[model samples]
Target: MATVGAGRDAGQNLCGCCDDVVGGLPTGSDLDLLREGLYGCFGGAFARELVVLSPGSIVLAGNHTDHQGGHAVACAVGSYARGIFRANGEGRIRVGGRGLPAIQLDSADLDARDGGLDDLSAMVRGMVALFLQRGLAPGDALGFDAYLALDEPVGSGLLGESALELAFAQGLNNLWAGGTLSGEELALAALRVARERLGGSSAPMWQLPVALGGIQHLSFADSGGAVAERIDFDFAQEGYNVCLVEVGDGRVTEPASCSSILQEMQAVAGALGAERLGDVREVDFMMDLPVIRDQFGDRAALRAIHFWREDRMVEHRVRALKAKDMHAFLELTRASGASTAMYLQGTPRVARSQAIMLGLAVADENLRHEGAACIHGGSPERAILAFVPDSVYELFSQGMNAIYGEGACRAYEVVDEGASAWWL
Candidate 1:
């Protein structure tokens, strides 16, 4: 329902000071990087109809808590997934992408796949299912030749899979549904796909940030639903730049190391007879600790402490962001990092990476720079996100990468726009 044009129009919403969201269009090099491997895959005909979607997400805080009905803060990032297609006129759908072979399915078989759906096929089948579930039949089938490019670091906590699913859903929905689905609807459909077929988690945390598009405070309600509130305050307004530093190369394969923590929290919640962990108070947890620990062990006690602290941290983080209190915000980041390390048991195999991250935070504070560093993602050792002043970024990046490796730090700005499409 939105439009993207080079010229300024009063009718179409513009991002910040420009007509383009996320600064501007992809740079020539950025476009070239995306197009590099797709030459032989799609000819000029298909390339001309490309529909580009918005970028992915980075969870700002409240990691590994969303699924258990806990809160989280997440935002859309600069990296994106794009697609190109035309009507195949064959009542069949085909999808092809990096490392995924091209697949074709008849429209009649949308509800029944021979062996169920993989990642790519899930997007098509999921969208079709969503349409059917809503009592709207997608008129025809169109095969897309698409490729996904992740601008974020490979092991970065950004949700590349969610980005791809959102892109595909947007493209297909636009084609079939006349783009009636809101960002939230698209995110819900993507969540269904992820849950039913792909066995992935973190839907609203990843999907809302990308779908709503921006630096947003995604508030998870007591009912386990979420609402995205656009954060109007810019980091540039406070002379700060957000950056993610790659501290390690390890990836957290699911049924991740964090599941134990989640299980422990859920068990604690059950023991308290509370519906959700967030509903269990600090007093309730502390008072019950002796009995809880006796029943669940020391790990459960420590995890309870983390759950309580993280709940408070998420609350305070929202306030800090709203107040534009960078100092308070950075302090909370350090506390979160410390809690994750000490109590939450977030070191996913490599303790050294976390140690270094904590060390950098100490150095950053000692230097009196207006910034803070913390373990970035759900996996404690993968990366660290720092809100550093633009002036100190080079010095900070150089020192961190000197130990971690070169090109380890990358900067990002929150942009306001979700999964959007423009006819190419």
Candidate 2:
């Protein structure tokens, strides 16, 4: 709703951290200094305009928030942060963010780049610095304003915040300076900026799903980062039902503390030279169960082992679904819920909510009994996925509304479109 234009009359001060020149344009003398310093470093005179979208909620399969690492899924929402630019002929960079703050960067010292200004505004500047360091044309001085908007509902468990920021950065690169930057290149650069510049690593996983979508099974290899592969399945014709239940009053939180659990998992991984937990197979889990229990105390160890096994079961079920083995998929879904209840020690509220939903779906006379349901792990809130007959879509909707109260959950038709870019 708010609009800011780039000009001295706008009456905004440059961010001190970035050493941006604010208020009034420089005369011929100032332009001379700028030209002398920036000409060689920036290469040529160019300008660009760009827009970026935010990322949605992050779903973790295993506990651990602090780089201990776990599997997660995220999507890019419709909202965005945008940047518009115009070359000033002089070496001056002006940036404005709607309803936030404005920043100006003066490239007066090409040989001496300040590294102390670390903040959100500095992120864009840092990206420019990085580009220059790589011997790429850093573009010319320009006047620009950045705008940000988010479309997803607040607190939806989607990583909208991180996604939007990264999208904006990528959009800038693609729009302003035309070049071929692979998805992996953009992802890695965005990840470093989010971590080093933004003080967080949570943005990486979230950005991946937005950049690449569809039903993907993701795994991160230590030396190689994340590896994503699409799972091929025709849900529409296969007659499989998938429902996402919103449980726990929608107050989602990160997974439980995982310091000790990660240490134990690491030990197991070390023995097998497996870089990731997913690489540890069923036999590895059984063998390391006792060691994990000893390290994490009995209860935590038991829950961790249970989740590991159940997660593997889910992965296998995904494979079964791909193979169109409906019976095996249903059985595994039921097993997954049971394991969460007995071994993972999921909250009573979550376990009961999922159980009741699945039970009702199975008992319904009109609804097919060949469906499957299980709790969606990672979110603090209780949520479930039900695989049901497509013919009963309306019936299932009505039944869920009747039981859980109206608007308790949202329903979306199953989609298979992989991630793609769109105008905001």
Candidate 3:
């Protein structure tokens, strides 16, 4: 554990220039814990203090279509990653997290490749660089310090890296830009940062639910970027409990593991004379099925089949949510799962395991026809999402627990709010 405090105490390491304070505290319900961590690292003379937060989210629909310019439904989960911020006069921006050493950089000059580009430090540098490039920098004489933490984390938390990315970006906007940058702007900037560092994994709304908040229907159909519309519905009104059923700790991401699926889908799209399956006409695909099967092989054809059906299914599911028809939404979700199993998983890949399949079978015994279960976070699946009606939430939870063990199922509410900043 990283200790918080001042004056070179053993094991209570002070991150870059930290001194004159006493100790550190773990994250909890309030900003007090983050406040202490900030004071311990950068001193407490700063009057301007802000808290920025974004929740973890789940991809509700559009399984294999994120990169193909297709539409999807997503919602913010109950878990959140938050940051406490304050301005420091030294022109040195610093960021620290619970149980981790702080990373500091000069505000006047920023570098994307500096300091392990794959980690959170890169994100901090990217935020500073973005503000500076946009002519939105507060000033050369000012800098900021943020203490980041996860509150009530479930499994890996909903946002993962994007959660921290959104929090830090928004904090910078509020502290330095006079809160001028909108939530959409911050989300786009984070997407840009991720693209530069990691090659654009979840564009066009790189974790928009976290940055923008609420249950949303997102479309990547526009080439310019993502389009998100607020979805208004009371999930609890229907008495359905949305939960994530832990499958197992997913394996270390091999670059080729997840990409392989996208590549396979791409091959089929190419056979149809289009860049992505979304752009291909259904008639064109059906007419060219023989060519696709003969040229790209059966696996590619099958994945393309999954993509087309899923592309349409996502919009249908979104409509179900908009219509407030829980039965329709649940039915669509099950159909999506069946389609992925039959078409997308045509070839055996060790990294993409069947644990999720087994978990779904267990959920079926309890859900019967009233609830639904499917892979939670898309490929390299680690958790299964189960929608249980409130009347049977207990039975559903207990049944999942029996198979996956106790505490495997965690209830999550779709938070209506998105990312925002407040002074304390």
Candidate 4:
């Protein structure tokens, strides 16, 4: 059996530069945010003892999982999932949380190998199945005993829970098999098992970027999978800043809206037979206005349109980064945020927060406000964020700290290294 511990040296292995960028201690507010998000998404009572696995590890695993039509992006943040696990030899699984009843699932049911093992718990089971299916193990000889922990109080815009699951699966596989896999391999393996065995809904697209770190553009076609291209942008050297601002009013629901937007965008792309909306350049807005209106009538459609166009802008940013044109890059980033607010009709909460952040940036004597940007359908509470050069991070951090109070905004040094795996 695999018995995991919250090691004494936990968090010590974190990159010093990352710690410096996010500031010292992980805030309590961050943990609260994560707890709330976990309840909302997973409906578990609560999470405790959060654990943050290295982003590098997750990224490496995610990349290795890539199939003909799969790609993932992930980031290792300052926070992680918090919880503990104990193996029950009685062929039963029991989970408990605050203000919630303990959830029990029989190990017999899990071992059935039927399609019913397709829920969250099944995700863990699927990893085990994959290990055996791949001939990496002789049998399900051991069960998992684990405790999840987190430093970040709240879930970031991305599906952090799944990220945690990926990390846990990786750690468990390593421990049980007494062997190591590259990060990319683990990520791909987990993704495949999750989709095929656990019935996960999302495409394997978003997983890689978060795993790998740095900015990336992803594309998926047909039923094949997806591909990712790293956008070569240097936030540290560039004279501008990138920040993610939270719109505290809470109108934005990322998972709910992002899926709809992606579906609509896909339909448009499929109908046009173009890779993305930006491919339809030089068309008069007035000429396409009726079609655009018919297809995407609501504000959500407008937001999707903004994403399509901004995707093209991201391509431009990629070029500018290559050319080392800092001015152009900053301008594009700001323009992207403007597009989000004006075209996409971002939530009022997000708009207000962004305006507040912009004001703070402008007032800063040392830092110039290059731009503000928000992901489509990002959590309304944390709607808008920005990117800034490393030179100005120190100068601008204080202003953000004052506005965000604590645990609101964070800064991280941009790393050029793409995703890869390391083992202990």
Best by lDDT: 3
| Better candidate by TM-score, 2 or 3 | 3
- Deviation of model 3 at 125, angstroms: 1.3
Query: What does the lDDT read for residue 326 in candidate 2?
Result: 74
* Local error of candidate 2 at residue 235 (angstroms): 2.7
Top-TM-score candidate index:
3
- What clash pairs does model 3 have? 4-23, 4-24, 5-22, 56-159, 213-418
Candidate 1, residues 278-327, lDDT tens digits: the string is: 67777878887789989999887887787668767987998998998888
Pairs clashing within candidate 1: 213-417
What are the per-model numbers of colliding residue pairs?
Answer: 1, 17, 5, 68
TM-score head-to-head 1 vs 3, winner: 3
Worst 10 residues of 3 by lDDT: 1-10
User: Over 4 Å off in model 1, which ranges?
Assistant: 1-39, 42-50, 98-101, 110-118, 137-147, 152-157, 222-224, 249-255, 349-369
Give lDDT per model, in order.
0.65, 0.46, 0.70, 0.45
Tens-place lDDT per residue, model 3, 1-424, is 0111111112322232433322221123345667777788877756666766666677777766777778877777767676788777788878877755578888766766743324666677777888888988766655778887775442253334566677777777777777777667777888888777545565654467776667778888765568888888777888888888876545444235457777877777776777777788878888888988888888788888888788889888888998999889999999988887788762234555657677878888888668888775443356777788888899889988888789888888887666666655
Give the 10-residue window scoring lowest on summed lDDT in candidate 2.
1-10
Candidate 1 structure lDDT: 0.65
How should the candidates be ordered by lDDT, best one leading? 3, 1, 2, 4
